[model samples]
Target: MSILYVLLTTFGVIFLESFLVALGNLRFLFLLNVSLFNKINWKHLLSLSVLSSLILDVIYHYVLGTNLLMVAVPLLIMMGISLAVPLENSLPGYSVKFVCIFLYYLFVAFVPNLILTGQGTVITGVMLGGMVLKAAISVLFCVAFDIVWSRLRKKEEGTKLRSL
Candidate 1:
């Protein structure tokens, strides 16, 4: 049930992001296409987001001694919000993506620590270090997913052409 919930939440966030990007409302123009609005591959994005979220959850639990859902739910929400609210004319480059992911994890990790436990002391700088680590992980995951998705799409197109 918990895993299902996490999967659903992660997919939902990814769908929202894809929709926003398709609408040309996203701040980052990392990739451009003629059919930017119509060519979004939602399934790929959702799968990638879920996989990345799972990885992040594992890291959080092993290192921070917290449950996966506790971290994943808020992180998904933060990423969704960040995607929905685009920065001014900011092209989505590696740096922009890195910062966005980092900020999402940092906020999800730190704010709760401060608010819920009232333990604001930095634990071996884990808060800061974790953000960078997670962000890099996310970026790499996204890049790999994008590559795989593109290849699959190309293959599908080629198959259709051959059949025709």
Candidate 2:
């Protein structure tokens, strides 16, 4: 995809999350993972991912040091994983990609915040049950995306078969 489209999609998703989820920033990590799995060159995807994160940091006005770490850490992990797995092939399937992407989103979203901002408040009695509410928005949207992507993929396959 063109860089402009990539950037627009990334920002659109980010805006959608911020508007809908009220600080839920899973979209960046989600897009980073998806773009990498598009079977494009890892270097290009990595650059775009980092650039997107940097743009986010700018928007949020995060401190220079922590902001840099926030972007760099995930990029490092992505590099490590790509090194171990063959990049020439796309991710095995959407389910596998979703799981990995979800886990990576957790790490990317929470860990750095913990490090830079310190451990958050205890999940005292009542708060413990609210975890589902916290996650439901992102998960539901992901399921919606899965439906859309799968339909698009099927259509693409049909067209390719017709062409053949």
Candidate 3:
């Protein structure tokens, strides 16, 4: 059931990102899910990341390996953070999530634009602003999910206690 949950959310992110213009190539949804939800095992998260990036690449018509490289770097960083740092529904955790999402935007949007357009390229205000907005939105969404999940867990615990 947890595997199914992970797969659904990961693929749902990929689907929205691939088809929706507003998503703007940012994988924050997936990043936040994997970072916050320890239920997703490492192996499944890794495979899903690789698969999603490839699918995004094909959908967006990028060079085959570009998305994989961009997506993998931040994913590894997030995985390390999730493992080493005890992130919960707190300020530090939220800050880390925002930073990770920002870095993901940098890698997915800025770096590729830099590489493709060469050193003479400028990142433009619109792109940077969009990244910030997306990151903020992702953080907010994570917080909301945490609240709902906590409520559900509490209700379940209460029910178990009553049964006892």
Best by TM-score: 3
| Model 1 RMSD, rounded to 1 decimal | 11.8
lDDT by residue (17-118, candidate 3, tens digit) is 755545454564355444445543566666666666667777767766677787667656776886766667788778777877777777766566555666
The residue-by-residue lDDT of candidate 1 on 4-110, one tens digit each, is 75466556554554564366333121122111212345453444444544544453343332323334444454356557654222345445556655655555555
Relative to the unseen true structure, what is the C-alpha lDDT of residue 129 in candidate 1, on a scale of 0 to 100?
Answer: 81
lDDT-based ranking, best first?
3, 2, 1
Model 2 gets an lDDT of 0.50
lDDT tens digits by residue: candidate 2, 1-164: 56776677667645764664466434444543444344445555565566656666666655444444644554455556666664332433333334444445445445556765876434444443343343344445555655555555544452222232
Count: clashes, candidate 1: 2
- Where does model 1 exceed 4 Å of error? 1-92, 113-124, 154-164
Q: Assess candidate 3 and give its TM-score to the true structure.
A: 0.69
- Model 3: which ten-residue window has the lowest total lDDT? 155-164
In candidate 1, what residue range of length 10 has the lowest lDDT sum?
27-36
Estimate the overall C-alpha local distance difference test score of candidate 3: 0.66
The lDDT of each candidate is: 0.46, 0.50, 0.66
